[model samples]
Target: MSEDTNATDDRLRLLIERIERLEEEKKGIADDIRDVYMEAKAVGYDPKIMRQIVRLRKMKPDDRSEQDMLLDTYKNALGMA
Candidate 1:
């Protein structure tokens, strides 16, 4: 085989291996997230809202302020504000 072909094949192999490793890591992280949700539910906390709260907490302060404004708007619309 030519050097060019060998180089291309090596690149393809490396890309495939990297993708496979990332996929496996993703699955493990997903399973861990699911386990955390189950544990939260067992402890009487709503997992869905807990997840949303965690996500919001990770946002920048400016982004969180915007989210808070929207939430307040929603509450006012529902006459709960």
Candidate 2:
């Protein structure tokens, strides 16, 4: 019974370590993506709109379509048609 407990503890510790490592990796990737966005902005690209496009792409298709419709409507209202 004691051996079983020790084995379980070891497994839990390993899993936790793996999760922590993955979280750190995710943070690094997010930072890298942010850096790319900054570079794009420096090149005269609109980072805010670029980020919105990227975020919309990650959403469900239905949601993306709805957002697109709303944006088009707004643009038309603003005479940017």
Best-performing candidate as measured by TM-score: 1
Please identify model 2 stretches exceeding 4 Å from their true place.
Answer: 68-81
Backbone-clash count (model 1): 0
Q: Candidate 2 on 1-81: residue-level lDDT in tens? A: 699999999999999999999999999999999999999999999999998889877999998889889999999999998
What candidate 1 gets wrong by more than 4 Å, as runs, is 77-80
Give every collision pair in model 2: none
What's the lDDT for residue 67 in model 1? Answer: 87
Worst 10 residues of 1 by lDDT: 48-57
Q: Candidate 1 lDDT, tens digit per residue, 30-56? A: 999999999999999999999889998
